[model samples]
Target: MFFNRRTPQSAARPTGRLRLGTAAVAVLGLGVLTACGGGSGCSSEAPDSTTIKDLVVDVLAEPDSLDPFYRNTAEAQRYYRLVYSSLLQWNEDGTLAPDLAAELPEVSKDRLTWTVKLREGVTFHDGSALTAADVVHTIEQAKDPENGAVWLAAMSYVESATAQGDDTVVLKLSEPYAYLDGKLAMLPIISDEDDYKPNATYATTGNGSGPYALASLKRGDALTLERNEDYYGEPMKFETITFKVVPEDASRIARLTNGDSHIVPDLPTDQVELVTKRNANAVTVESNVSRLFAYPSMKADRPTSNTDFRLAIAYAVDRQRIVDQVYSGAGRPNSTYLTYGTLHHDEDLGLAFGAEPDLAKAKEHLAASGVELDRKFNIIAVNDPQVTSAATILQSNLKDLGIESTVESQDVAGFYANLVSGDYDLILFDAPASTSTGFAPDYVNGGLNSQAANNFAKFADAEMDDLLDVALTAQGEEAQAEAWRAVQQRDVETQGNIQLVVSQSSQAWSKQLVGYEPSALLWLNTLRDVT
Candidate 1:
């Protein structure tokens, strides 16, 4: 699952200059390196002229696809970071950093148009030259549903995506969108030619203006990549690398421990004790991955349709207990939907949830709503171990309040279908991202829309709609900030479907893995220099 929080294009009347990607480097508070130096399509601390070595990585879920546009999940986006390029990228601190684009965009006085300059000598993985035409075609294709740009569907404000020159791209908007940079940050550009597959498969085949190429593919097992010798930036550290899919969390950790693999993600929380005791030489870096337990606003008639009911559930939930029992205190607590460390969080928004269980208070709300005890509900979640565990915990928590709950586990295909079909009651919805530090186009009206936030659930607020309208039409940091703050307060205080919690992101790596950042985005191309 890729992290959300990208801003939308529709709000800004984004004419499609360059919508930024998820500026997640500022996770909830963190932030991309995509402006120029196309070597691996990643954000780098420093540039090196020397050759880099090759390394393989292991992850929990096999990448869903290699098609950059359709790949919106964190894992897919991370992979694209290595293989694709974008106008602007996010730094680790959630700042609006540059990537494929040479410099920051020039927004017009009216905020309806934006101009971006391309980095010098950047080329697609196909060795095709980069130009204004490529950018426009790629972006327009993204808006086309048939093109499979999941990230693009969320951005609707772009009225025109055009090229100002061979190296400059201009976007004209119907409105003013602040998160355009964030939106572009999430979408790494690819060739618009028909040589590539618009409908890619999980078989994992991809090529772009990135640092690596698809060297090999083996469905349900592994993927091998070859470094792009002509990469636009510093050459990668690795000559050859493999992405081994180890679905079992324990096995992934075991491979790292046995030195069979260099890196692995989604390591089991339960096994932390054993790994620390056994792999003293290994380094475990904890990251804040954003996730929210969405009751999906589907129950328009049920007690959950009420904001009070949602808050009660949020209040009743002992997030600390989950941290203690399920996560072992490896993660941090979250308040706003944005990740930790980012700006704009209401630091003073005290937790409605208290220490200790409050099933009585929970039941009282249900009683007042007349929803009745023993009301059966379904909690849908992706098949991650932690998610499953969380669902079970919710089951028990709701049960304590006299509600009968069942846990439903499904793969991504089934999960999305169920979510969109409105078949389930509650789901583990990964909220679109927008943190204290920033937002990309994908998270806002420009990217994946809250229609899911609403359709699956139907949360409608006149105030929020008004804020979005004003924010979309306004310009300048002051105006946008004021509107955005109102939006954040509303979501944080009441309509918070995307919750806040530092995620238990695990990376089991042996000493052999040197440069790879163990990210949910699964960025490995950036680790090419690893010996």
Candidate 2:
């Protein structure tokens, strides 16, 4: 899924490049032979011949699509950061800065109109000049209903985008959104917006204006990228980056320890020290924007549709035990849907369940559910080590309540497909909200509404929908906070989903890498700054 389909080769060296099928390296254990050797793409050579200036990363899975308008997977979002440039960019400290825009947007006194000036001398990878027209086209396509854009909900407030001249674009908003700049930071500017539809050149391969460009890709195997020498911003320190597909956690950790790769993200908590003990470095970046959550299927035919049954499942599980055992105590147990860093979350909000299990309360809810003991609940999850471990713990917790259940693990693609189809009683996964504005208007308004496309749980409630609308459209901070609190209280009472804990973003890098920093807003985009 990393690239379009390509034929396999033993070891083909292009005119000036050596292609290493890294997906095969997992079985061969050839750690040292994967270096980019004396290639034209290698602008400068490393001091050691075994490793070059190129950054080799071991990733778990390939993204389903490279198009920004279609898929919003974590892997694809990181790829977009490398290949595309946005109107605004977030600084490491979570401040907004100009990227493609000449400066911060100029807002009207009423905060309804936004005026942006495009930067001059910037060019797309396809050699087209970037202008205000591209920006207008991007926003129009994103907000259009016929496009079926994944970001349609986030762009609802944007009424219209019009270009004044060659360099200026103006936006008219339906309401005054305080966080509109943060949303602009997430929108990537694309060239030739006329061809930005599905199955176009921008879908299979990226044509962007960022620091990197796709050189070659072998589907499900390896991806090779070359630095954009004509980039307008600060050039990438590394000349090229090679992403190797290594699905097994142990193999990925071993590759990092043996100096096969420079960076590996999402390391298992127990294996963090293994890389640190060696010459490598391991870091766990804490983030409250993302959380590990369990969402119950709210289909009317399913037993989990009952509020009492859902609450019983929520109260029966011991979140503290799961946090300690599965996560190595790196996170805090949470009972509410929103994390502490989410917009409008406060200490006085709803937390219907305790951190530890309450068996008596669980029994009371179970008796009130009227669910038969013979019905077996099917819990679905991805086939990761920690995810499977958490599923087992939840399985045991349900057994204690005289309930029968089974854990069904699938690969990432299958897991997401099943989740969207609503074929399971429960689904467990991590939700990474990669925006500086937190998870309020986008995830809350889109992921929980009954008729919304991303509402995977099929949860339907008119009051919940109204509360979400208030949370998104409210003008003042106090009004927004009050609406968010009401939404959480309703969420707790309904138990549409169970929030488990806020997990830390963990990764390990080789000591040879320098100037690396952890970022909650920009995950691997920071790699451009690392040498």
Q: Which model scores highest in TM-score?
A: 2
**Candidate 1 Cα deviation (angstroms), residue 20:** 14
Question: Candidate 1 at 142: error in angstroms?
Answer: 2.9
> Mind sharing the TM-score for model 1?
0.78
Each prediction's TM-score against the native?
A: 0.78, 0.84
lDDT of 2 by residue, 1-531 (tens): 011112211211112101111211122111111112211122232233234568888888776667877666666776778888989876544456799999999999998999998889999888888888888888887777666566666677889899988799999998775557767877777775447775355666888899898887777977777899999998878788887889888888889878888788767656766766665666554441346678787777777888899888888988777778877775556566655445555434423576677888888998999878567888887766677788889899999988888998777667765566666788887766444323233356556777554566778889988787777677666776687788888877886677776554567766556545444453475665554
| Model 2: worst 10 consecutive residues (lDDT sum) | 12-21
Taken over the whole model, the C-alpha lDDT of each candidate is 0.56, 0.68
- Worst lDDT 10-window in candidate 1: 7-16
Clashes of 1: 99
Steric clashes per prediction: 99, 0
